[model samples]
Target: MTADDRIAITDLINLHGHLTDRGDFDGLAALFTPGVVYDVSALGGGELTGLEALRAAALALGEANPVAHHVTNIVLRETADGVVHALSKGLGIMADGSAGSVTYEDTLERTPAGWRITHRVVRPRRTPLRG
Candidate 1:
């Protein structure tokens, strides 16, 4: 991938946070492939397949969704498999002033429209115990 491709992929990952924070389900769904696989089992959300399923889950959240989503530490890697692997950290600020962090493991591919996430696994970050 070229430098522009890397930039585009980074932008795509960042855009997800913006769309989700705004509750723009339609726009959020467009960020993924039609047959995207979104796994949030770590958060008890179960695995959601396809764009329609993703949209449904987002809409179901309603006002219960986080007020803001901040993504950082986005590391992109291109493998021999022809897919870009993106590992990022996401911090969600809730309406009640509580915040939680998770690691987003994503795989993106180049599509006709642009680079899109084909698969994502949302893993909750555990607090490290002090010895």
Candidate 2:
């Protein structure tokens, strides 16, 4: 990917946190494709497809949603199939001051609008077992 592509993708990932923390579900959903697949099964949310499903899921959280979201360590790679894969770390701070972290695996493609996530898998960050 070109430098501009990387910056755009990075900005897109960062925008997610801002939109979500602001409870702008509509803006958040705009970051993904219409037929996006969001797999949060590791967090017991199962898989959600489509922009409507994503918006519904976020709205369903209500006050349970995190107070803030921070994303870092974004690594993007392009595959032979012309899709970009992005892996990043996400830190979510809850309203109760509790925080949790997860790994966000995302697949994105260049759409007519812009680079949008087509699929994403949110996995809990596990601590390594003691030796």
Candidate 3:
């Protein structure tokens, strides 16, 4: 990935994390298109869309559990509509110390402001058992 693409993708993901940590529903909802798809099967299934619904779901989840999301290994590719596909690994931390990590498949769109995520998917996987 080009340096600029990497930077843009990183910024978007960082902003998402920040919004998530702060429980900034309004801001997070605004980041997506009218019909954004959020798929984190660990939480539920298939596809999810609409910023309002997304915000509500996120807030509800946040209220139930204090958590942190960390992402890495971001891969960026340009899409036909000028959107950017960003793939990465994500780790989720809970308040009580329990944690889970997974591979995050995300797609972001380029806008006047910059890159904004249009879709996000996470496949949950348990930590490898140590010998």
What local distance difference test score does each model get? 0.89, 0.92, 0.74
Candidate 3 at 18: error in angstroms? 1.2
For candidate 1, the lDDT comes to 0.89
In candidate 3, what are the lDDT values of residues 1-131, reduced to their tens digit? Answer: 46887786787776776777787877874466667788866767556677777776776666554478887777777766776777788777888888887887787876676667778887887768799
Between candidates 1 and 3, the lDDT winner:
1
TM-score for all predictions? Answer: 0.92, 0.94, 0.80
Q: Give a tens-digit lDDT track for model 1, residues 1-131.
A: 88999999999899998887776777865679888999999999999999889778878987778899999999999999779999999999889999899999999998889889999999988796689
Among the numbered candidates, top lDDT falls to: 2
Residues 1-131, candidate 2: write the lDDT tens digits: 89999999999999999988887877865689888999999999999999889878988988989999999999999999889999999999999999899999999999889899999999997686689
Q: Is candidate 1 or candidate 2 better by lDDT?
A: 2
Off by over 4 Å in 3: 79-81, 127-131
Residue 21, candidate 3: Cα error in Å is 1.1
Give the lowest summed-lDDT range of ten residues in model 2. 21-30
The candidate maximizing TM-score is 2
